[model samples]
Target: MALGHRARAVIGSIAAAAALGALLTGCSTSSDEPAEAAEQAVEVDPALRAMLPGELLAESTRITVGTESGYPPFEYTNEAGRIVGFEIDLFDAASDRLGLKYTFHDMLFDSLLGELYASNVDVIAAAMSDTAERQADYDFVDYYNDSDAIMVPAGNPEGIKNLKDLCGRTVAVLTGSTQEEALAGLNAAECQDKPVEVVQFDTDADALAHVQEGKADAELTQWSTGAYNAKQVGSGDIFEVANTEIINPTPLGFVFLKGDVELVRAYQAAVQSIIDDGTYAEILKKHDLSAGAIEKATINNQPQG
Candidate 1:
């Protein structure tokens, strides 16, 4: 991606609502209890230490993880200015399992891959989808599954009930996202009369702002993110996820530099250890993201077409 072309910046309008509760459709996290029963810590396996790369084991005590702290419930800064979310919790469990320490750096989502390639960070934990295209540059330890949804202003004043409703209308989407590609496909297939006017923004927060301010008719984004953003921006008073067929189901993962096979293997093993020990499920449950939890800690094995 071009460093010069950044997505619209995430405005500070909704920064106060970063800690919105989970109320995503088709899922419920409000009633779920915390993953831990008490103050128990995840057990680390000494044997796993051998799996780490020589460079990692010999040089670094703490791994620096890159993340876009705008997406709530997955990874976002809380009121305390600390990044906290489901992804953070899962990383904590994985780190505990491998006896590793980590520090997270918040930056624009699109810049993460470049940062990783430049060795500015060790891994990316930005809820990034693991696609074949990305696998060409980096390896991913797949962790969760998610799909897309179209979100519009609350009450859906424009009556955008589904994807078809976006035909001939302007739609806001995050720049460089699969959502834009999906909408392009939709326009090519269905919007022959009037193609979808895709308004790309630098961040989900900005894309969300576009729709909320009536600059765009709706925004197409991940289902959970749409729901989370809706709850956060206006506490569900400004936007709501439209009733649309879930589209483009994708696997999200923690990304490592390509050819870093040993590091990938180490992280994969640590993730699997969490999954096997039930800490993975517990973390998802606590975040109300149990629905997106993967059954296994697979490598970049997801279908890319």
Candidate 2:
């Protein structure tokens, strides 16, 4: 199979580690917390509110959301030490539209699914993609899409501009991620003569550090995230996204455990309501993530179909 085709087959694995590193950093609640609040409250849609399950609105009128806050432009700690990002903004907008209150908890990314399954969280608003495999275990309210890309040191020291360039070179990837699989497949099929050397790290920061310290020639992650990290943590001078096409672009969304059709419907309607009212676009623009915007909210998005 061609690189893109092979990439599509492995995209499911990609979502598994999208924010592992970010999640590990923990939540940031600054003194200026209220300042990080959403700029505007959305007008609630009565119909959407009516669709919410009684349990969701019963006791507190709040949806407890689990988020991995270390990823930027989506969910990350700002200079002011408060949790803020386009995803948080979107959550605030959706809650307003649905006339519901929400409280976010910061935790490890790997714990998100377990928490959801245990009813510890009503929703997961992390930048999690709704891959088909995950859909089997949960329902999704799809919002935006993104892709995995490469990041290399500044000045393109290794002259690594594309996936092919990773051949015979040490490449850093998140441990247990599909990105690792994709690179391995590419090496086995296309770079047999000079197989890509793969190094797996527990977190994105560690993987990135490997690349920065010259331990690895390239690192793979969400393209937007790579750019954000390169700028925010690396000072924009230490790294640059390699000029290569993404192996596969994936849809990112909010997750709820399986069998919550009512809650799922409520969230989907609330999200679509924001899209229609232009609130979604404004939030994305505010975070410079307008490119990640999706036109309509979807349930259980399975692009591989």
Candidate 3:
């Protein structure tokens, strides 16, 4: 469905309202409940907590985390060249709780996975969606839930509203992302007879740039990514994100070497502790991102490959 200008404004207002409400509520559970009840609220496997550090270091130590610091609101280097965002802060909270230290290495989003697989970095916190295929290569600590969306220049000059609308148009997507997979499926199903051109970029910003310059008809990226990008570069009016169903909803998580059960458990415990408290929600709110928070089911489900 084509969203009218008024409709887009309303969606923007709703997104802002939800973000503010989440910030005000934070992550605090019901206060009337006993501490024991809150503690028992989420049953984290004891095996995960068993991986705690033997002795907390007096001085700060460092754990290397790989991320493409260009994907703002997720992980990105600000104007000062400092890496900051939801994922960075989440990991900082995790490190603080674990009494460990960390440093972030920014690289191409796609390369972060390879760096983890090669043991080049201890972990990856790059807003990476955890999928069965990816789980086969690395362990994950589920955190954010995300879906795909389409970004078109303001006014949607081309009248693009959804995937089906792009029957013969060119679409830009980041390499090595679920968006790519989804676009491939869409093309195969709807445009196979007259394939839609898919242009892959090394970074999401690059892909969005393609749309901005009219090189691409639409840019398919994570919903949050598109929202943040449009807000930042499109002045909240330069680009419009289409709420179309594309890929299956997936949870974004941190990736570590496969079989590192010990580390995964430790991270999981840290994440749970943050969630049980209010730190996790606070971080999300700070970034205007709360819809991305993991739901109850996602937290309980065991990681599967």
Q: Tell me, by TM-score, which candidate is best.
A: 1
Model 1 residue runs over 4 Å out of place are 1-40, 302-305
Clashing pairs in 2: none
Task: Give the residue spans of candidate 2 off by over 4 A.
Answer: 1-25, 28-38, 176-178, 184-195, 302-305
The residue pairs found clashing in candidate 1 are: 7-202, 8-202
For residue 192, model 1's alpha carbon misses the true position, in angstroms, by: 4.1
Model 3 lDDT at residue 24:
24
Lowest lDDT 10-residue stretch of candidate 2: 1-10
Across residues 1-305, which tens digit of lDDT does each residue of candidate 3 receive? 01111111111123422432311211111112222111123333344434654322334334456677667788766565566678877777665566555555566777777666655556788888888888887778888888777899888888777777877898999998988888888888998877778999988888988988899999988888888887887358878886556446788888877765555667887887778677788788888889878643132247433
Listed in order, each prediction's TM-score against the native is: 0.82, 0.81, 0.78
Candidate 1 lDDT at 228 equals: 78
Where is model 1 poorest over a 10-residue stretch in terms of lDDT?
23-32
TM-score of 1: 0.82
Q: Name the better of 2 and 3 by TM-score.
A: 2
> Candidate 2 has what TM-score?
0.81
Query: What lDDT score goes with residue 142 in model 3?
Result: 88
Cα deviation at 19, candidate 3, in Å, is 41
Minimum summed lDDT over a 10-residue window in model 3 is located at: 1-10
Query: 1-305 in candidate 2: lDDT tens per residue?
Result: 11111110111133433433455345523221364544566777888888876544553444557787766777877676667888888877777677777666677665777767766566788787677777888888899988887889888977887788888999998764557767988888889999999998766678899998898999987777887887876457888888666666878889887877777788888888888888888787787777778887888874321
